[model samples]
Target: MFDYSKLITGDMPGDKIQIGDSHIKRSDTVFPILLKKVKASGKTKIVISVYGGSGVGKSEIGSLLATRFRSNGYGAYVLSGDNYPYRIPAENDRERENRFRYGGLSAIAESDGFCSDWMDIVHDAWLSGADADPELAEKYEFMRDYQEAGKTALSAFLCTPEEIDFGLVNRIIKKFKHGEKQISLKRMGRAPEELYFESVDFSSTKILIIEWTHGNNSALEGVDFPVFLYSTPEQTLEHRISRARDKGVDSPFTSIVLEIEQQKLNEQAQTASITIGKDGELIV
Candidate 1:
């Protein structure tokens, strides 16, 4: 059952709220501030990104925030980050390896035969690493290192933001922002066989809510409200374990992936507008 009371508040206390053993009060402290920001933005259409490391409650909090938006008389839609992957789960591993070995975007395009000007730029930037193109090098150096690392090190490099279909995601968001009435979105079910597309009615949707670890990036540009949750790898272990069990996918590999994901996600936190602490308290 969902807790509605937790999603609403009269006034926020400076200190943490104790609810049984849970000291996290994100719903009370964070949601209210977000609501105010949405209302004050004065934009008929708004995009909110709830981003953080794995098992940090991005999906749950995003859903709650969307409900809050709807309750406040705004039409809202929640976009799943999982749907933006460049390839299906099974193929992504191969793709990541290709990217690391062959030179980022160039390698991916050559093998896949799906070339793009954007990819060309990315490829050039990566090769120009630390020379004249410091920015591009910085962006892609990790990918180069990943390619050179052993199989054991590869697990940590998998599923980073570089693997997402950023171009597709950006296009979808732009279309919606431009008042596109209808859009098709991919929804991944529990299994790969369940992947399917559903047409969404964005005709009246005033707010688009996207929650993912990599939300604070160029791919999600133009988002009106961006929320970053701060949770260390230690803090995330319990939630990750529970989620994995529920998904029937608890394993050593998943644990390693989550640890690496935490490291990458923490690096992206600096790009967020609002940062929430591990205790669910807002950090000024």
Candidate 2:
């Protein structure tokens, strides 16, 4: 009923992935439509982005689509937007934490609700990485102010030029579309020394699949078809917990990040050429 005859997974280094029945079904929903568009466009090079909320299976579904495309006699590659972040995971985590704390405290200090006692409490909450916990906010009213302000600041920081190297990604897309045979693609790791690039053959590639959380991001140009795999934060949480994607994936602070990401994805999903719901049903 499907093809896994070739590699459709993203090129990110050191990734352990699992694709499920739902992902396959969703990919099947969109692949034929995408193929039709690719055929009609008559463009030698086409870029498709598979993006969605955290743990929504962008990487998994993108790979499946790519594999089907290749097995049907078209060349394709899945590029990871994760590798384009300005900082490594460890460094970026620290920066995001700093932003949340700073942004939250700054707002609280400026508001009439500024109380040294509450400020200290909020400070401690952030240190424990529970500032964004809904239960904590409900238990302690002061946390609500910090959580709101922190998420606002995160909206300004996440997936923007400050965090993601959109320019570099755009340039790579340009080269691919302009007939570059082999291109140097970036590879990033959790450490400083892990930043590097590898020359990859794009000579036979006709369709380029960028599977990432930020694939639908505004700064990422040149995507002829944008696909959004929609999943609510709660849904994503369950999946991430099962996958053991990373440390703190189930943490409240991480949940705050996922909330912010979902907000952005919802806004971006409007423009997606294809959108799949959590139930593996096509929404758009």
Q: How many collisions between residues are there in candidate 2?
A: 1
- Candidate 1: clashing residue pairs, number: 0
Across 66-100, the per-residue lDDT of candidate 1 in tens digits comes to 76777878877778776777666566644644434
What residue pairs clash in candidate 1, if any at all? none
Give lDDT tens digits, candidate 2, residues 1-284.
Answer: 66465556788888766878888889888989999999999899999999988778888888999999988899989998889998988889889988988888888788886688886777677677777788877886667777888888887998799999999999999999999998999998777898999999999999999988999898989999999998899998998898885788888888888888888889998899999887779895
Per-candidate TM-scores read: 0.67, 0.94
The Cα local distance difference test for each model comes to 0.62, 0.87
Off by over 4 Å in 2: none
The TM-score of candidate 2 is: 0.94
**Candidate 1 local Cα displacement, residue 208, angstroms:** 0.7
